[model samples]
Target: MSKHPLLVRDVLKRKHFESAKLIAGQQGLNRQVLWTHILEIKDFDTLINGGELILTTGVGLQLERETQIAYLENLIRNGAAALCIEIGDYFNYVPAELVAMANAHDFPIIIFEEVVRFIDITQDLHTYIINQHQQALTQLDTISRTFMELSLMPNGILKILQVLHQDTDALFLFVSEDTKSFYYPIEAKKYLHLMEDHCQQLELHEPIQLMSIDKDHFVIIPVNGLGQVWGYLCMRSALPKPSDYTLLNLERATMSIAQILMRNRMLQERQQSREDEFILALIQGEPIDLQYYQSYLPMESRNLFYRVVVFNMLDYANTFSEEDWQEIQLQNVMFVRSIIKKLGFFPTVSVRQHEIIILAFYIAADDMEENRDSFNQAIQQIVARKTPQLFEQITLTFGISNVYQSINSVQQGYKEAKTTIQMQHNELASSIYYKDLGVYRLLLHQDHVALLQYVKDYLQEILLIDQKNGNDLYQTLCVYLACNGAKNDTAEQLFIVRQTLYKRIERLENILGADFLQAPHRLNIEIAVKAYELLKKTAPDILRF
Candidate 1:
């Protein structure tokens, strides 16, 4: 809050006033000026201080209309609380031209009775100003507590609005350069569409300033701290003519808290943004020791494995905010983690929209196959919990990679999980594993880089060759992977009878490899098939909201 001169109204009521401009004299009378906050002076181009009285005879007024306009313009432009023009000089009345402009602009224009010197008003008004300034300061403690409660602690910017709306009794808006609502206390907080016409006077036109709202009835205080404007403050119920100390002191009182809140809000948002970015980076590539997740990793884990679950979200164009989707992903991922933990597999979840990822540590390679069912069941339970019951069209397929001895194997794990999903033969498949993938599934056979590249090339192959025959390829792979490679089970699983299964298997062996039907040959084919399946499922469909 600025420290305005005390008793300015009473001083104006006196025969002579003592504001900074009045004290500076009507014409040249060399004297060092005090008051700094009241920048408004007639043709006063310099930045202003708020204390002292500015007194001018009709000398400033007798100048040409443009000069008079410029003089008054500067005083009002600088945010002078009251303009005192003496009736003794030039004429006893305020100039019609100046009055019209001042009335239209609403810069306070006060005409003293002219029977006394302006200096007499200053002496009388000063003590009254001091008392009021002290009283407003006494309320500081309550203001601080109220501001903290009403404001968003996470976004310090909230403090500014809280002060403006709650304490100062004015609606508040935090606007961006585009004049859109960066934040607002009122729902109807309008954009700055009328800035050029309505609110420019209060505009410091520099970095920060406090000016009265039009008609001199309210103050629009700026909340610019740390060299950035977090937003603006609008104060209501301005006095008919406030003392200098009232204006300046109130400004000074509010200034510190507003700035501190803005700085805090900026810092908090930055932290959240960085945390989100780190999580996203982990999902896109390999997991790392990101600080937020580091403390949460499974302790005493010997071997860790991951399951990559990419949601093939339908109707991306239908959703508007990323925040909503990310929230859904978080809820579902937590649900999946909880279910897996209940079933005794330690799960750590990391996620972003359209992609839900989980890393399960403390399970050895030998235990992976044994626990795979519980893992699948846990994921299924997660879908039931997080997603709405009516969302039957949604699917939650998973890609489980063969357990790797190292955490760096997250890449492979992701690939395998995706393969499990891709090879499934359903338009809306959910909660699947890579081991369930089959022959045309080359993804599991390759490393991360090779697998992604292979899928890209395969898609191009289809596009170039114009082949539409993959329905069978997809089915064969699904059956083989789902049944875990026993020829009888794979055939029985598809319910195709053995001979037809055998023929389809033979065709796959021809395209993928002649050795695919044999022992070691089948082993390599399974890996390639699994890798391809995961890649097909995960890599092809993910998209933005």
Candidate 2:
């Protein structure tokens, strides 16, 4: 149904206003007349509430010219839609100054050339407006029912936007939390960037309001569901201001969209809970019949290659309340799932407290190395482009495992992914792959007790010496070893002079022995340094020494 409010021009067609002449304010003919009020009083301060068509005799205008002008100004200031004055009885005509002022403000002045009852005009317009409103409510109810039916469909969100677009002929855009934007009427896609730019500038928590962009008007409505905002619905139109009926229609449509979103979320949560259980079982080394559960997996082909990626939110517990942390975790899961899907991988994702675990699958290609390179590049893009957008103050660390041909090896992959994250010592390198971990690859798999004993055997004296004196001997030894026993490079890296480096080296040799830099001792010392750093990150309590 085409729902529109009663306009001033429509009021002129009524029988009571048949003899009325619009004396001024020709531009105000299109003003909406929501209700009619007969105000004979000179003081109309509280009586006018905008959009009210006032019916009056010239009784108030029979006062002084200033009082007459003040009365008209008061009606205009209070946002009365129009002034209908009887010209024959109380006054011969509307004053010249009043007509000029009304014309200037586009405040309509309708003068009755013959005597007419104020009650008849008001009763006529008020009944029509009330009946129009009742009819609008009935039409809105029908449209609402249509929306509810649409919500049950698989493409309910797009369908909802389609119906709204068809009803209003306005460009409809829905932007989801994952930054996935959907537009109706296909041609409206050109405005996607424009709407997104405006959305970014808006304070999302604010109430729905009209916004003008590049001379076009848009009604931005937040699709709120499940105690959170799922997305934004922006309806663009050529109208300077949308009519109240259109706003009402859009509000009803937005509520239906929210219902669709909530329904989809609930269904996804149900499916996700089952998937999480399955993934948890796999990662926990529970025996599973892969053939029996093939439908649950993202891919059913046994020829597919699988890899696990674990995303760890660093220091989230300290940074956010428990409720906020849960919300963050939920957002991270959805965000990561979108990224993985965009990269063309079927991602089986699960969230465990602070960690998001994703098992990615791709069909085994002829050139495995090229596939791996593409996967790494995709991951790099996410880390470089998307991570900063979602996590400004929060830090996210990613660990990727080596590819496995069999799904049965998922437990091993999960361990490797977690270990890859744990073995990282530098916070600057947020994304790490198992294949790129170098010597830590070998040490990470070793028992913590063995790793700790190995670190103590090689660097026990130096660690104790530095711990006692709070000196740079341990760091100097690491730099010296890293620089391949080159004193100059080591001193440059340490920001120390050669003589000072010589003294530290002399101190290290006295504690770790003179041949520590030779052959196997050099290799062992390097391994011990790596093991120490890894343990410091992964198992700090083991390095009590």
Candidate 3:
């Protein structure tokens, strides 16, 4: 394998530089030398590029001690790799002031005890740098080919990261859009807090450099995928700055990541098209050849249990245009699939009618009660906890179904989950499982007219009272019941004064009859209010008619 260019110490080992002795800045012996130049004037700092060594006969140092120190500081600031001065040509020895400044700034200073021709030094170093550049190009070609092959493998980008961390001898990380999680080098857990400060900068998709509190340098290369930035390739090393070779390798690795991401997206899109077709058919109770859907639906479901989850992205459906929403739906399907994969199950994910539908397999449970706890923990921790905040401007509500033996029961589970979502009515909760929904499931199966009539029977007086009097009594009643009849809590919830709430409650009591707050009455009122809200949420246009 080709190696990086020579450092200042490497040049000192050369025959042309045999007369050179380090006088200061021993710590900077490892500074890389990209090229060498001869300086004959005091203003040569402006002529040098970073990482180049300056060889002079102290022509630039023939000034006041303070001015000489200033010139030395300017050369260091210009990023010259090191300074080599012929001592006998100037004052027979290096200046103490210059030596102190070089040592303090870790800027290497070399003294040539014997006269060395500047033409020969620059000639030999330039040839060596050119050779090193050629070697680097050769090595980059090999790395590009290797990464191309890796990108075709499973978890290819991660495989590239494994190789990269080894090659660069640095910490490598891939941070997702969320920035709260690490995608590669699972051991990156310790650096999360240090990395968070750089997340916003990463999203700009521009190259950035950051320094941690611990003074470590990080180079962030954003991985662009499909016109948007997907994540970042972060390199952290003990070197004060990365060498050009390291950056070249990082750029190549980033290209590989982008290629892998695009390929994975295309594959996902094709697979998602098929998966959606199968899932849409399954949920609609249509017939499908089991052999054809074998890839999307887990074969484990044939013996184990399965559950269906219906997720609705509330508040967001109204915000984005239909075309933009469609793209978001596809992205969300892939993201949800990743989250579900970590839950240790085979999941079939799809987008249907603006909602995400998932069918995931579960380990065979002896009885429903036996697996409920672990299943609920996974639901709460993995599915519910991670899905909502996965996208900005979108919060998700999940309706989950109970585990069933046969995959054929998936249709029933899907329907149950869909109804459970209506029961939730976009509540603040993350999810509502069908098994936990109790009587609401029974109500969902009942005739719509009967449920409507039941609600109107208990709420018609209050509804009509509010409409005729131009009051918000119906809303107040709902808040009061939600607050469990606590007057102060109800007032606070409604953003009203206590006295106003008391007056509203008194009016409600009189309008609905003095016994309205008594037993059975309150229960009927709560159920009626919930049904009314659910109806409006489920079919607002139908209720208008």
Please name the candidate that would achieve the greatest TM-score relative to the true structure: 3
Backbone clashes per model, in order? 75, 0, 0
Q: Weakest 10 consecutive residues, lDDT, candidate 3?
A: 381-390
lDDT of each: 0.50, 0.80, 0.74
RMSD of 3: 9.3
Ranking by TM-score: 3, 2, 1
Q: lDDT per residue, candidate 2, 208-284, as tens digits?
A: 87878677888888876533456789888987788877878877887888777655654575467767877899999
- By summed lDDT, which 10 consecutive residues of candidate 2 come out lowest? 422-431
**Alpha-carbon RMSD to native, per candidate:** 19.5, 9.3, 9.3
TM-score of each: 0.32, 0.55, 0.60
For candidate 3, write residues 1-545 as lDDT tens digits: 12576899898999888767899999888988888888767676558878889888887677788778778888888998999989875747677888888999888999888888888989888888888888888888898899999988987877888888778778787766532344346665567655655765553624655555567777777776433456777877787667778888988898888787766664666566788888888788898898987887655534477788888776676677887777667766656665556556678887864588888776654655235554566556544434332455565567888877676788998988877776667551234778877555566566778778887788888787777888999999888877778898899999999999989989888877667667788777777776776676655655522
Ranking of all candidate structures by their lDDT, best first: 2, 3, 1
> Worst 10-residue stretch by lDDT in candidate 1?
24-33
Say which prediction, candidate 1 or candidate 3, comes out ahead on TM-score.
3
Candidate 2: Cα lDDT at 325: 69
In angstroms, give how far residue 247 of model 3 lies from its true place. 2.9
Number of the top lDDT candidate: 2
| Per-residue error (Å), model 3, residue 93 | 2.4
